[model samples]
Target: MAPLMNRSFTTANTPGIVHIADSAAKRINSINAKAASNPPQAFRITVDSGGCHGYQYVMGLTKEINPAEDVVFEKDGAKVVVDKVSLDLCTGSTLEFVEELIGSSFQVVGNPKAETSCGCKISFNVN
Candidate 1:
């Protein structure tokens, strides 16, 4: 078995940082409004080893805060949080919300460190 290879990100100096696109912010704000309680929350993003590629992204909404573990990004009253480990793979990436005929969702775009990405756009590989 191979050890888990933890490749250091170039943006290590500024870890847990992510960029939010305008469309994403708008969508997040709308979602927050629809929440009946504990609204105006943050999107917490996580990455783990999975998918046909080496990594996958996960996200959820949260009202809780843990200063030691999360880095936050904000725009137009919307907030996003990326934990240290996930940020290593996500730093300098743009978070966008897209609406397609199939459905709509938030996605990571412009990941400079990814060598190749799956057709689904949810998985990626790095050198």
Candidate 2:
């Protein structure tokens, strides 16, 4: 896929893996530095139902990984893991860290499967 917002991203050779942009990796490293955990943390992404746009993108930090259920993507020293079920909804998408006058957050960008996204850009609908 082409670069988005001038940010470059890399994905695993395996399919169903979401790509992480360089900007997003830098932001993830920043967040991990402030986390009050001993072993640091990794970003976790999950897609859940019930947003105004039908599916909501949820992001958080974690220190544990259930290898059988999660796929981890890494860049620099930052890592992001998406559960298997969520991967199905996010295949071929790029997760970007964006800052605007409103605020800054992780967002799912360039999702070919998404039909429409909410104003907040945290929720979306797929065909």
Candidate 3:
């Protein structure tokens, strides 16, 4: 589980919105197009505890979803899912696909609830 979000930081977002960058949506579409699953797949983001920072982001491609616990954000026929708890902690964030010298990956950027995040970008701390 991720560290609890500071309640004070949770109210800055517009509910039911999760921004997907053009690069992220394109990447999601590419991944889903190659998926063999009958239902295709969605990129899942789950925040968990234990990192240099108070919380870390765990992401993967998933074919399963728990409706009650998951929130789906879609763009350009691509899907990104996050649990309700994580949504509360990062509602105003943008999902971005970054290409770097090391590799390319999905990252959460512009999180209004994050006080500070690690240089690696996978871990964050909320004030």
Error of 1 at 20 (Å): 0.4
Task: Give the whole-model CA lDDT for all candidates, comma-separated.
Answer: 0.77, 0.80, 0.78
How do the residues 64-119 of candidate 1 rate in per-residue lDDT, one tens digit apiece?
A: 86767766677766778888778888787889998898888899989888889998
The alpha-carbon RMSD values of the candidates against the true structure, listed in the order shown, are 8.9, 5.0, 7.7
* Candidate that would win on lDDT: 2
Screening candidate 1 with a backbone cut-off below 3 angstroms (N, C-alpha, C), the clashing residue pairs are none
lDDT comparing candidate 2 with the true structure: 0.80
Clash numbers, per candidate: 0, 0, 0
Candidate 3, residues 23-84: lDDT per residue as tens digits?
A: 99888888777664668688888888878888888989898988777877777667788888
Colliding pairs, model 2: none
Residues 6-121, candidate 2, lDDT per residue (tens digit)?
Answer: 33333444458677888899998887777655666888989999789999999988989887788877777677888888888888888899988888888988887889999988
Q: For every model shown, what is its TM-score relative to the native structure?
A: 0.84, 0.84, 0.83
Worst 10 residues of 3 by lDDT: 2-11
